[model samples]
Target: PDIELHPSDKAASFSLVLKGTSDSRTTAYKDPARIYGSSHSEFTARKRLEITANGLRALAAEVKVHETNNEILGADTDVGGLFAGMARNTAMKKARERIPDAEALAARRVRERVASRLNQEVDASVTSINRRLRQGPGAALEQHGLGPASLAAHSTSKELVVEASLLFANQLAAGSPPAALPKGARAVVQIHESAVNNAIDQLGLAGQTIEGAHVRERIAQALAPVFGTSVKLPDDPEQQAPEGSITFAARAPLRVRFVDGQIEVILHAASLQRGNLKTPAQVIRARYQPVLAENRVTLRRQGDVEIRAAEISPEVVSISLQGFAAARDAAIGAALRAPMDRVFRPQINSPKAFTITTELGNVVPLEVTALESRDGWLTLAVR
Candidate 1:
């Protein structure tokens, strides 16, 4: 079989030419005498059949994304076959001459059979491909709270090129089409900051609040070793904490922004309370530089998280308590940084995060070769 691809902007067309031959033999016997059977004669017929199918046209179909699965539209193909040749034995010469245009009739029958078989095979292949797609990439996208926003496919002389844009679930499919994949790269994934934020929203991290008692307990646990003693923190606003004890409460929503070749996480706290003192709302910005590793891309924290007081003076406290304020700010920063790192480390640093499995059970590991973040898009180049 020879296959050729013709690609246009909207869809790709394919033509297939198939050639094959088949041979078969048949035997028949006739008894001359009934009761006193005297003799029997046997006749044998052999034939070699050749068929060629040309202009079998197949077109790349449109793909639609659904909630539970995907749909393939216009998956029909046009098949045409011709009976090229047929070799018959001498024993079948008399039978062949008895019918008018016997060869032509045989050719038509063979052509019909070939066309039917080809159509069946094409249908089966399409069904299998559709099922595998739904089970593999479709399921994976849903797992990450993403779906295809738009899809287009075209056939080049060498291959079929497919381009698709992804959107977070429930997000409106409105955006400029993504840029083409980088040359020589097997695959590239371009993620927008809004998509990341949507995933975070799916995780229920936005507007999450930590109770003061829970916050104080975690702080004490973290500072116990540094202070060389177990710390007891009081959460009541009216109660006074011991020298090393602290109480904290925060309600912050996590958001991500892609800018300047880095990812900046903005944790804006709407309410923050420390024991009897209620501090003004603050913005905790953590910048991460994306670094490409052997099999994954990780966001490494650029520096200590920046704590900026929102709508207030730079000083976290009065001048007289400068020393105490410095220590308090350090502890609070440490507390905030730990959990954020924990939440992001597995997602950003693990090689499995860049791996995908096909329905055929083939594992394709995306080895990160380059990473770039700018203009609200984070692009990863994989080999």
Candidate 2:
């Protein structure tokens, strides 16, 4: 697989394509865990941790929820997906029942009320903290260049801790049942011990290592038990944030649901295209960038020759396909030739969908589509 990253300014984003690769082959060769199993212990452990962390995160979630609740309720608030997540959970249902027509207008209203009450409580705490940091005791620090104790500053600081904590808590609470361990789940099932152990460990430790790390970090200085673990949570948006730049992390491979089964493409490269090939002294010569750090840039790139067919009218096929956008200069040239003379229409290949067109600006659709880079050019029957 060839991978390349062109800066957005340098080029329009290219969708990577994998040819002659199947999920079976990938599963057997690349990621067996994804194909056969996942971290079940981590998942189970997460549920347990979420329950424990609820108290920790609730303190923060409540404040932020309160701050935004009133504003959202008063405005055109849509809690459309907020509670959609655990709609099956009884706690969520009961929480929503406090407001009538939760499926309609009242869901946001209920949330608003909750958020408003919590906001008032948060405001009170902020006020108390500010007073102490000001004249109560820490006046010396504020007077010096160290820090100034203002209610706003105190609220901001508290907000960060509470917000981060609540964020983790909400994740924990997300799939939680009204109670833990339903009575019927105590059966001793036949399964691999390693698998069961793995699942359990995931359920217990994954969330803490990933998101709960923030709370652990904030209390790091004072807590002695928390050793060797950094308080900084990697998934937290605010932590280590470069100014004005947001970071998005990919935890796993992107699973694409396809018609036959499912096709998973591990795109190590930003844009996946079949590199153009030229032979230099019996070696394939192509110049392009490979996505992998180890294979960053290739001096002479060689790639498989793809089949391309164009079916535009001889007169205007050149203008129609060339003018239409393309993946490469070769694509533009192939479309300009209008080679597919016998088919019903000009067939342009696309991985997800296919479009058929003519020189007269008429378009026909085909179910059997092809990838843009897979084939060079195949002209179809022009209607």
lDDT per model vs. reference: 0.48, 0.23
**Per-prediction TM-score:** 0.47, 0.15
For residues 1-383, write the lDDT of model 1, one tens digit per residue: 45555655555445554555422222322121111111111211111111111111333322111111111111111222442112122223334342344334434444555556655655455556566555655554555455555666656666545545545546533254255556666556676776555544544334545554354355344334322345654233434332221122232255678889898877666655545544445576778888866555566778666765544465745788767766766666555554433323322353524677743456877666767888887777766
* Clash number for each model: 0, 39
Tens-place lDDT per residue, model 2, 240-324, is: 3111110111221111111121111111111111123211111111111111123121111123222232233467546556645
Best by lDDT: 1
lDDT of 2 at 351: 30
Q: lDDT of model 2 at residue 162?
A: 12
Whose TM-score is greatest here?
A: 1
